[model samples]
Target chain A: MNIYEIEHNREIVHPNTRMADVIEADYRILPLLYRIGIELGFGEKSISEVCCESGINPNSFLLICNTYLLTDYSPSSELIGSANPSDLIKYLSSSHSYYLNECIRELEGLIDKVASDLPANQRDLITTFYKVYRKELENHFSYEEDIVFPYVRRVIEHKEENEKFTIGTFEKNHSNVDEKINDLKSIVMKYIHSTGNRFESMQLLSTLYILERDLMKHTFIEDHILIPMINLLEQSHDSQ
Target chain B: MTANNKRVLIITPSRIVAEGLITILTQAGGFTIERVISSISRENENLLHTIPADIIIADPSMFGFNILQTLKNRLSEFTTAPLVSLSTMPMSRTIAANFDEHISMFDTAPEIVKKLRNITIVDTSNSEESQDNNIGELTSREKEILVKVASGHSNKQIADQLNLSVHTVITHRKNITHKTGIKTIAGLTVYALLNNLITTPNENL
Candidate 1:
């Protein structure tokens, strides 16, 4: 967390540690290294050598690589180009499961529970908004999982072709799910008067907050870590 | 709430402890002592919500009130501010885990200020990149300009404040941005937060 201490130690990357050793220590970072275009079976070479070969800032690269060890999420742009996309892919996939399976499902039920107490017109409007948002979220996740992730995998697998597709395409399509969720939060917090069921309102607000925060973290990992790594790959491919 | 000045809310039962902190903080300058509440009672509980603080330093056991419970109850309001638990005993593990920090009362005033400065930086901002702690090497003039820039002042405003030409202000900003690789005001704001050039904004509430 302290960047000065990290830089002054003269230990940006462990000079002698092999890629295999790094993966062995924490398999979670495996995709992170891969996103940086480092081959998984990287011939026992040190990270410094790989960073040098790839033209990445070693200090910034290692900071992102070590982020898996942090218990709490803190956003940092330093890891942008140096992240391993596959590592991000792995982390992001699980997050997708949590959102689609748990968060959306739970929110749908809560929205229904709260809507039951409202006027028919008001209930219909609120439910319609929730439905539209849920669909949008589902579609966003599907695009990443189906199209973007497959493209990234092909690049990682070294099957990249001279195609117009790039991470920039994904970035352009990326939706801020958090903003929609915030709209939902404002609707509930400010507009929806409590119908003597304070408990339902509180639960709805709390759920929205968790979804908002979690989605923000998820998008950050994509925008900051995954996309940046993919862009690095695209640049290298261009020079080829 | 003072719009520009950073406020600190100290919750302690002891009058002497509260006054001693008020004196030290006032001498530090630039800090406005929001209030020193003797207990986390109904009257004081209202203050926690009314007066937004950059930092809240409290003794959880001073009045036998669970300060953490009070914080947890209104977690959203206090999310951006750093919460420090000052006590003699080994801080409860939960306090260490939950609060932004834990410091002993015996710690020096400078140490407390340092902790406050560190935690005030908005970690959520993508500008968490450190300047490698290079704020030390900045000239006093550059530091002054950098502080102004970080606090959302325009170059023209900074020039007028420091009695410098806009061109000179721009040059200092370029040097700072080049040295730090942070050209945006938000990034510089975080840099200022780290170096204690400005206090955490009180409008987070």
Candidate 2:
């Protein structure tokens, strides 16, 4: 489920909305909140209730709620301006772990299964492609986790913005992770012929497609939401 | 050229119409006339497989309903490029709606270019995220089918994946269409991409 539906038809972002209902709506939101150290366990209560119970800063809670609830891609001022940088840093770090450990690992197993039965040459080609794509994705994610997130933390702490390594540089130099994945999808879709194992091929393709979709969403959170918020913080720091 | 530059394919048997479009579309220099397929035939369709275009403008006078419909259906299989049919006379909204958008012979160069620019922006961006995400009443099962459909899965393929009959898949698709009010696969695909139901190349970039 996308944020657009929740924002328009359902009112999931109101301060009074129960945290339980929000979690029920999209279980993924749980991990995001958990990253920010907000755990909703056994207490069927509103966001305010949970925030109060956990003694979490109310501003940070609202910032996160708005990020998950708003349909548009634009990050809110509250999220960019007020929320603690440590909170976002922790959230993004956990997301990186999920990608490297869970998503990529699962896809690797599926690829091994699917490519095992193919001819030697075809299998070699597929394996090589997968390895290259895997490396690129890992590099991209780590670049964010190691370089970008820490920079964001420093900026949040009012450290001088890196004169050489601005956010615009990262934006401009963003890797073509999506393009390589797209090539993989095209290769499987257009070139690879099923060797009578239609089910296996379907499974492989479905996994690739889902991985691509998930990665894009992850990148969206980083590029569209996270980067902009950090930039806002940087601007405010510079002016001060 | 960058990916944003419009790559247009003109399919008109009439040299007059094709040249007119070429002149007008290239006047401002943003559009790259990728190819001018003289007519829609088996051969031109094959050519489309190789040269992926951004916009396709076809004059439907020669083929009428059957051929035009066939071309539209065939093009939908491979590319998300907008298939715009050029109409000489006033066309019905239903027919116009079949294609992404229609233009008339009377439309001046500036007007035609304006429509092309509008479509280019829509095609390139996730601006249509709201329209796509308004799937208010679809069940999770139906939503799954919609994702599969947007991913270019045929009904039979989707049925096999879900272990349901093809008929069941078709019914779900129809229900999805009824609820979402988006009938064409291209439209649905755009909606899907916007709502992150599917993935595309460097969409954020």
Candidate 3:
């Protein structure tokens, strides 16, 4: 089976499940764990124990983990109710930092190295394409951070409803920031075959694929977990 | 030196004009002047057909009164290569319309390079889009649906507009997602923009 393929019978991560075992199940969860503020040195601690130590809500942590790990997993209203919006926001903000500061910065460096081995026109094309993608990604994340996140925080904390802005507004404008990366990958694969350093190009492509997958997951969390949770909050506030 | 360098075939009767273009294009970079011919006649007609070129820069004035007929009959084999008018003198609008692009003597090196690059880039990308098999080029019907989807139309709306069943629209959308490897509507919009399915971002959005 493909590593990313959802297995119906695969064990789900529970509060009592060993944190180490979660990583062993799929190493991809390491980034998720890191974004959620769960550090290493769990030392046989259960998920609940780690959450307790980190001052995280165990139920919310499990919801995020199961949602991310299991492709078929959909967060029910109960799951959304159990998740703390502030915790989700913190996790998502950290994920944005990971993508912008760490992931894309690394990609920019790799692409530059790869471009060094290509012809001048191809080099300019690849570099310019990547720069446009990076700008779009930065804009996407900034919209969320500047507009969406702050509004959600205000709604949660002060119960102050902004008639002008809501999660629905976010849902409408939430552009697929990951699609351009897919285009860049295909463009490179199709056109950039005669590069001097094949290894560096391969590294760049692999990093792009990883970033695409991670961005999809991040968007999923925002669409499914974050949106529904905020929608529920909005409905409650409206009824009051 | 690379294959990416666009092959430019200069066809002008004046040696000074041809040499000047060669110097400018060489300085501007990303172009290789493949051949320079002073004039085309029955003896040299075969040379035009034999030489491979991505673009053709020709002086229409050299063809005299019957410029359009001369171009159509003589350069019939080079339908794929964009014929750019290398304007040394003021030309009529009707005569100018025969060529794909125009380059004036007053134009700067960067301006000339920009015009050439625009034509080459669009020409190469169109050819690549058709020839490339790995990306699974979208069919006309699929492209039509992609435009609708990129414009933020729902499956039901697309079905209504295109006079198809909702189920058929859904199936077409699924195939689009599969072929493009893009799931989100925003992603599809960007794809449409990149592929020139939609001319501008705000056109249908």
* lDDT per model vs. reference: 0.63, 0.64, 0.75
Model 1, span A5-95: residue lDDT tens: 1111122235467767777776766545544556654686787777667665554456555544332233344445545566567657766
DockQ for model 2 equals: 0.03
User: What lDDT tens digits, residue by residue, belong to model 2 across residues B39-134?
Assistant: 543323435766657888877665656556777766764565688878776765656767887788998878888888887665323322222332
Ranking of all predicted structures according to DockQ, beginning with the best and ending with the worst: 3, 2, 1
The DockQ figures for the candidates are 0.02, 0.03, 0.03
Model 3's CAPRI class?
incorrect
Candidate 3 regions exceeding 4 Å error are: A1-11, B1-205
Give one digit per residue, the lDDT tens place, for model 2 in A140-174: 87888787777777777777545677776776676
RMSD vs true structure, all candidates: 19.8, 18.4, 25.2
- Interface RMSD, all models, one decimal each? 18.8, 19.0, 25.1
Candidate of highest TM-score: 3
Per-residue error at B135 for model 2, in Å? Answer: 27
Better of 1 and 2 by DockQ: 2
Lowest-scoring 10 consecutive residues by lDDT in candidate 2 chain B? B126-135
DockQ top scorer:
3
- Which of the two, 2 or 3, has more DockQ? 3
The best-first sequence of candidates by lDDT reads 3, 2, 1
